[model samples]
Target: MILFFGTRPGKTVITQLPDTACPYCNQIGTLQVSKTSSYFHLFWIKLFKITTDTIAECSHCKRVYYENEFTEAMRKELP
Candidate 1:
């Protein structure tokens, strides 16, 4: 018998931050937050979620910020 199991990324959820400025570009209302979940799968079927990651991106500068790189203002806007 053979088995196939692995982990895959789930759908991404995006949220717009109003009145929020990008930490790097300093552009207001251009910051968007994206949340993604990783799930464990067995035989192409998702079994359970492993972890979730949050990130912020600047539409102006195109910079991506991870959770560890989030600022105080950015943290407050997270849901």
Candidate 2:
């Protein structure tokens, strides 16, 4: 249920496709993205955009990744 960060209907637990990466440690295994939300208003409410919490985590390092923030991107570089 690969949950896209800052998407609609809230978060969905992802499984079956195999673990991707730590998004922190860059290690691939049992890494999961969590249920969190942010905002983007097109034709809707008052708030145009706001940042909530959509963190990807590294079970190893226990670091929280905020949407594609610094730690998340660095995962790819890990060996």
Best by lDDT: 1
> What's every prediction's RMSD, in angstroms?
1.2, 10.3
Q: Residues 22-43, candidate 2, lDDT per residue (tens digit)?
A: 5445676745556444565444
lDDT tens digits, residue span 1-79, model 1: 9999999999999999888888787899998899999999999999999999998889999999999998898888778
CA displacement after TM-score superposition, residue 30 of candidate 1 (Å): 0.3
Among these predictions, the greatest TM-score belongs to 1
lDDT at 14, model 2: 42
RMSD of 2: 10.3
- What candidate 1 gets wrong by more than 4 Å, as runs, is none
Give model 1 RMSD, 1 decimal: 1.2
Task: Give the residue spans of candidate 2 off by over 4 A.
Answer: 1-17, 37-52, 70-79
User: What TM-score goes with each of the models?
Assistant: 0.87, 0.39
Worst 10 residues of 2 by lDDT: 9-18
lDDT of 2 at 18: 36
